[model samples]
Target: MSDVKKIATRDSYGAALVELGKEHDNVVVLDADLAAATKTCVFKKTFPERHIDCGIAEQNMIVAAAGLSTMGLVPFASSFAMFAAGRAFEQVRNSVGYPHLNVKIGATHGGISVGEDGASHQCCEDFALMRSIPGMVVLCPADDVEARAAMKAAYEHEGPVYLRFGRLAIPVFHDEENFHFEIGRGEVLRKGSDVALISTGLMTAEALAAADELAQAGIHARVINLCSIKPLDEELVLKAARECGRIVTCEEHSVIGGLGEAVCAAVAEAGVACRVKRVGVNDEFGHSGPAKEVLAQFGLDAAGIVRAAKSLLG
Candidate 1:
């Protein structure tokens, strides 16, 4: 493995939008007065005509994006995860999800990693909200390369998609040239037989670090990045459960209705015999603090993951 380069997934999303703008003329972007913060400003600068600022009305922005999709335009509605997935949920569920329109919701600043933004801005329930919508593809990319690839995949996909991005700068572990990104496939970064550390979003980086720490303690860990939360890679998950006999799910979001729950549901439905443990915010809200501090406080960091893995293994 090479030295990791740190980059925010939101930045990757912005760059991907610009590249998509050049590739597809039908691609349009809509932001709810948070273009700079959500990194949609890059798209606005590159394709001024294709970008639309919808003021602070998140509901109207989502509805307008749904309308734009009806006109055969692939609309990417960009905003903070809280507002996009929480505030405009009714609009998204009714307008886009109900009609099964080709609208991509680029929700940046997802999870408690929003840091000083506090509970109001930090969205930890986006996965729950997005996953509840039928026919909606929920994707949470782990790093820059996956974020870029996910954006492209969402654009090419025909149905509604909710692409979750983060504010924190995470390690970019995947090399774009050799990385394989499929919409519903989980990638195994490490191979081990003791325990499988399945993670999503920024938590994948922590899982990798925890794997290294576990190795030193003579506990081999298999790290799997479940980028696609909805339409999850059930095959890989069950395979890991059956082979490893121990499963630990880590995510920046809540323990409920997130990656942890998804893994549990998959394993239970498949009747996979494995002990499962979750490492995430334990059914609570976020507070104002530094991102790393907040993550460590909630046991969503590497040490936390290692602890969870050890507990599960025992």
Candidate 2:
């Protein structure tokens, strides 16, 4: 296999938006005083007329984007995960979610991976917050390439979509051509019978690496990249429960109501009795440090996945 690229998921959103903007004239990009930080500056430079920077007010930016969507234009609003989901949630729920608007929320710096910014900027509860909102499609792309494809899928799919990206420069696991990405479908990266590793966002890469490590230790692990969270692929999750016998779910979000909890709900409702272990932020505040180190400190890294897999097996 060729070497995978190392790119931040936020970069993928910007690059994909540029391509989408070139293909469709009706596609508009909006930013909340974070065009440069959120990487929407590229789109702004490319499509000055279509790109709208709504200053620092994320709530107003969301309403403005929703207004554009009502006008038949596809608007992608960009902001940090914390402010976008927390501050602008009411506007998002009322103006966008209530109307089932086709507005795309591209939230970068998601979860603890924001690093150095501490817990204030770390939106580990974003998945839970957005998923609770009605008619929202929560998307957490695994890598830069997947983030790019997610941008396209979120745009094509009608309704309110929340795309979560991170600041960390993680490994690009999925090849843009080979990995088939649909809005509500889960992609199985590797198949195994011993245990299943269900993950999303940058944690998917960690899951894959942990799977490889487990394989070297004679533990076969299946890796499932769950891109869509809200309209989760229950069929795939049930299959993992029935076949794998045990599961370990990983995500950058909190363990409370994030990917791990979501998977458990699917397995339980399906009446599939399987061992499930979760590795993620455990409802604790994070400290200032590098993204990778902070993740390791909080037990959201590959070592965490490996430990969870072994514990579940035991």
Candidate 3:
């Protein structure tokens, strides 16, 4: 795993912005004084005139992005998840989400992956917060390939989009030349019948690894990657529940209202008689520690997914 090519999703977000800027003159980038950390500064290097520094006022920055959208410019307001989705909730909901503006929020450093940034920076509830808004499209990309593709999709889609990225540099598994990403769709990476391992964000890679571990135990777990959280791939989730009869959801977010709840809701509404378990951070705040250690402590890694699947099968 150490030898594998790895790049943080935040870096991918910045690279994608450069590509979008080069292609579309209407594209504009804005940041709440976090151009470097959130990686929006890369776009500023190429299109300095198009980038705006909002100077730490996240709420005001969101409103400005909304205003820019009305002027026919595609604005990507960048910030940390804690500020982008937390501090600017009211403005994002009313200013951007209410009118369904074409404002793409590049929220980086989501979940406990912020590591030593501690509980104050770790936002385990951003998915729930962003998903509550009407007409808001929520997306959490798994890797570099998915993040880049998701950015392009959000730019093309007309509505409020919350693009979640992470600080950790995870594996680049998806082949860029072959991978395809839609606004509201999921793909089954591995086939199985004993159980289904569905996940989003960084956990998608862990789910794939867990499938390998389950195979050794003859459990034959299926792996599902769900980068889109708002307009969930209910059709794919229902199909998994019906076929597998048992499912385990993995995410870097909290189990309360994130990917787990989304899957459970889909199963319940479809009347699927499948048992499900959520592999994610519990209803608790994260502590200051190394990112990998914190993820292991909260059981958000491959071992956690495997443990949840075994529990369901047993």
Best by TM-score: 3
In the predicted model 2, the residue pairs found to clash are none
Using lDDT as the yardstick, the better of models 1 and 2 is 1
What lDDT score belongs to each candidate, Candidate 1 first? 0.94, 0.90, 0.95
TM-score of each: 0.98, 0.97, 0.99
| Model 3 residue 50 distance off true place after TM-score fit, in angstroms | 0.8
Q: Tell me which residue pairs clash in candidate 1.
A: none
Per-residue CA lDDT of candidate 2, range 1-314, in tens? 23766899898888999999999999999998888889999999999998898888899999999999999999999999999998898898899998899999999999988999898999988898899889899999988888988888887898899999988888987766787788889988998989999999999988988999999999999999999998999999999999998999999988988888999999998899898998888878777899888999988888999999999887
Model 3 misplaced stretches (Cα beyond 4 Å): none
lDDT of 2 at 261: 94
Question: Which candidate would rank higher by TM-score, 1 or 2?
Answer: 1
Output the worst ten-in-a-row residue range by lDDT, candidate 1: 1-10
> Once superposed on the true structure, which residue ranges of model 1 sit more than 4 Å away at CA?
1-3
Candidate 1 residue lDDT tens string, 37-106: 8899999998999999999999999999999999999999999999999999999999999999999999
Scored by lDDT, the top model is 3
Q: Which 10 consecutive positions of candidate 3 have the poorest summed lDDT? A: 1-10
Q: In candidate 2, which residue ranges exceed 4 Å CA deviation?
A: 1-3
Considering only N, C-alpha and C atoms within 3 Å, which residue pairs clash in candidate 3? none
| TM-score: model 3 vs. ground truth | 0.99
